[model samples]
Target: MTVAAISWSAANARRMERQFLLNPAKPGQAGPGEVVDAMLAAHAQVMSAAELSVGLRMDGATRLDVRDALWGEEPSLVKTYGPRGTIHFLPVSELPMWTGALSAVPGGPSPFKAGDRLTPSQTDEIVGAIGEALDGACLTIDELSDEVVARTGPWAGDLVLPAFQGMWPRWRSVMHVAGHRGVLCFAPNRGRKVTYTRPSAAGSEEPPLSAEVAAGRLVRRFLYAYGPATSPEFAKWAAAPARWAGEVFASLASAGEIEAVEMEGVPSSWVVAGDTEFPAEPVRGVRLLPYFDAYVIASHPRERLFPGRAYERALAGGQAGNFPVLLVDGIVAGVWHQRRSGRRITVTVEPLGSLNAGQERELEGQAERVGEVLEGWAELVVGPVAVGAHA
Candidate 1:
């Protein structure tokens, strides 16, 4: 089919608006769950960063509000192993879609050797035990380990899987898979230690959609938020095989769920069949994004999002989200860092080029907004950042 073409700048502008970076929800009007739904999933490898990621997208949201949404009596979000097998904050309403989509990803071989890895039968037993153990109860890793070992066997608890500084129990390797299977999820932190529980506790146990249905939903969602993108980019973002992603995209296109698009200087891409809309002007604003922000991580044509100096300053190798980025009009322009003391937070920005006085003031306001999301007073400083990526 003949595809319509779009400029990279136009694509970026549309994506920024979809991601809530261009025009976020009004203060006190929207909740963290809405932001989570927009981004597909908010990375939670760094919990504080995840909170800011969701909070910043909602004009008046605070860290406490994010916390409440996750752990309150009627929680609206579930912290779990999301895409790429990493911790993420998923909207509770979409748990079934997330579980089905994530669990269907083709897994590679285990890193552990024969002796260290759990046998297929053992793995099944452990997965079952995890669901049973976590049902209606929150347990720390150690506590869960003990329960799993007792329910399964000593081999389930054997310390053989090599980890940083130490070896992990054999069953721990399947923990993420269990989460994808909808049997495990994170609970509120117990003191300083993280705890796990079953997602069933947060809501009724709804069955996950079939793999095909789930994959279709996920691909359309990705396109809605970051489209005019390619199968390979979606593969990278979802950690699914490139071939598998291509097949999924082809199926969606064939079914008329999506249509191909031509991006000048970019390979073939697609978007929701009738969803082609771009802003009259490029997105304009200075925004501060926390570490691993979904926009920086998921947006495609890497060079387009992190143009020129931002490629060197904000990214580690070709990967994004290692450094908190400063975006000028939807494109990365610099990097930034924050240091908090008591109720005050210091924001230090390192822009690639000189900013006009108005831009500088806008940046200061962006920094102050960052502090507000974190529930602190922010002081902005425009200068060099001393730290390196992911520091």
Candidate 2:
């Protein structure tokens, strides 16, 4: 059947969830850490560095183990590629193609465009100086800036700081491009320090794919990983231009990679892999999805994924800043937070609507799991903590 025919019924959503959310089995695995690493590489979202660490913990993976398995051997590879402008733990085989696609897309607005002004040439020099300083050493952004000022004479003192003040936007663009070129990659951070490394010779010599091809490949990957999505969803999630997003979907359709699907009540057309199909029932459990989790942040038209009234509360502040939420039966039922007092770790669940006994128990269980991954010895407490209603 064509994509337009298959509706994203509750069954379809659950099937996608099982494939991408639940950890895969690895029989006769070598190390616990390695097995966890593979699971994360395949499923976890690494779009934001902080999100990567948090997602692992939520998925029953520990911080130390994640670092040991994914970051221990080749520190540089971790930082090089992934979705959004962040570093995801992608399969080594998919690294080259993914990075190439992301780099071809033009970056979003730079925060530096506001007050801190620098000509394009000056910005180039600033980046060049930072790169030179980080030639062989892994330094934090602060350290890199310090080194740039120390070596660049007068430009380093005041001009560099202001010029570089709002530079993350610009630097991120360069990072995207350089990441595609296999020049720099994401590594573990020591506090605010940004640990980076040069890409391997093999990664460096690889040629980038054309923009159209890269976009198509990326869309396909997203569909396979987070399928039954729409062009707008793909566009928002990948940060690709709308026109490019449409083209990618069209190209995928041409290649038989995606088929259109219709939501029962929604009017817009959705796309999923040609082979994509969901089960007949929904998984009965509550899952604590971390902030900016792929499942939550994969698209802008999130109303389909969440209840209508609860949207404003979950996304309390605004679209750009959404609080961490609890997903019950593929719908956002409430928001959750962790409070640590001395040795006790208290997980407070604030449901937007009244929850039944089963849902409450499920939330408690999920909260306990979160506690286990975060603090090994801390006491776990799960229940409602009164908080003001959110808009």
Candidate 3:
């Protein structure tokens, strides 16, 4: 395969993340209006608050207008989903199916594993209290925990008081299960409330799609958006169990939606829908990617998406802290830091290697674009700092 094919595959793999992929115009190039148009054209219905910020920067969109345009008018433009139990934006139209697919698997474990302070009965009591307290009102986690304690008194004490640590994971799982069963649905937190609330009852219990069917749909979507991915990469991205992911791929292969490809000296299969095209030639530009950007996280085997040496430098010592990144010529060249002071924002970049004059200019331009999105004047600083320097 040509270098363009490899790059396209990598880009698509990143796009499969959907929420994490931000389609912004290159810096100093696309205007704010054009950026918003590009975002709309990408079929993004809802965007995460952070993802939206990055999107605006990438698209040269005015920072002030970002939230209002995408989420203010349509409150459902951004929300959360997934097994890791983190926040993500899903297009309103796709929420139901996505949630169904995500909630199919019971969350991994609760803090109250085998040995903990609370007994089984006590745990059940705590769960019941939370359910009762949140019956009609939306509450922040803190508020809910407080109410549970007030209501159950001694039992809540036994379950949450001492450390109140282990109870959180279990509670999250319970709430997830409740949401899956239609006992509750997520709504905007607003202020004073928590991350979600009980949404309307309509379309709540449409009967969850089977896991296999859901997996199939998820795989197809990933391949379409981030095709030419290895099974492990697909498994990681889908957050599906390995065996289940394997089975899903098998089913898709049987249906002829994917085909095998060779990478390095090994034979691997990736989704293929005939031929594809590269975005453009000489893909030279700078992009500021947000934390957990799909481009950085997708591709089960990360080596497929980034240079092995660069990955090591980016994630020094194995502690993958969320650091903003600087991408040059379609590859991650270094990491960036953004610090805000009053009306001014300072952007510091630590390059992994020497940058050409063109790359430097592109990086500065991207920083300016980020300033526009953030609605703050920005200063760009570049250096060859060590990987763990800032950390």
> How do all models score by TM-score?
0.97, 0.74, 0.72
Backbone clashes in each candidate structure, one number apiece?
0, 7, 8
Q: Lowest-scoring 10 consecutive residues by lDDT in candidate 2?
A: 34-43
lDDT of each: 0.89, 0.54, 0.53
How far residue 320's Cα lies from its native spot in candidate 3, in Å, is: 6.0
For model 1, how does the per-residue alpha-carbon lDDT over 333-371 read when each residue is reduced to its tens digit? 999999999989999999998888888988988898889
Better of 1 and 3 by lDDT: 1
The parts of candidate 2 lying over 4 Å away from their true place are 1-4, 11-60, 74-77, 80-91, 108-136, 146-177, 190-192, 201-210, 265-273, 299-301, 317-321, 377-391
Off by over 4 Å in 3: 1-49, 52-54, 62-66, 69-71, 106-111, 115-137, 146-170, 173-195, 199-210, 264-266, 272-282, 316-321, 384-391
The top-ranked prediction according to TM-score is: 1
Compared with the true structure, what per-residue lDDT tens digits does model 2 show for residues 213-259?
77777776566545556787777776667787787777777787777
Report each candidate's C-alpha RMSD, comma-separated, in the order given. Answer: 1.3, 5.1, 6.1
Considering summed lDDT, which 10 consecutive residues are worst modelled in model 1?
Answer: 22-31
Any runs in candidate 1 off by more than 4 Å, and if so which? 27-29
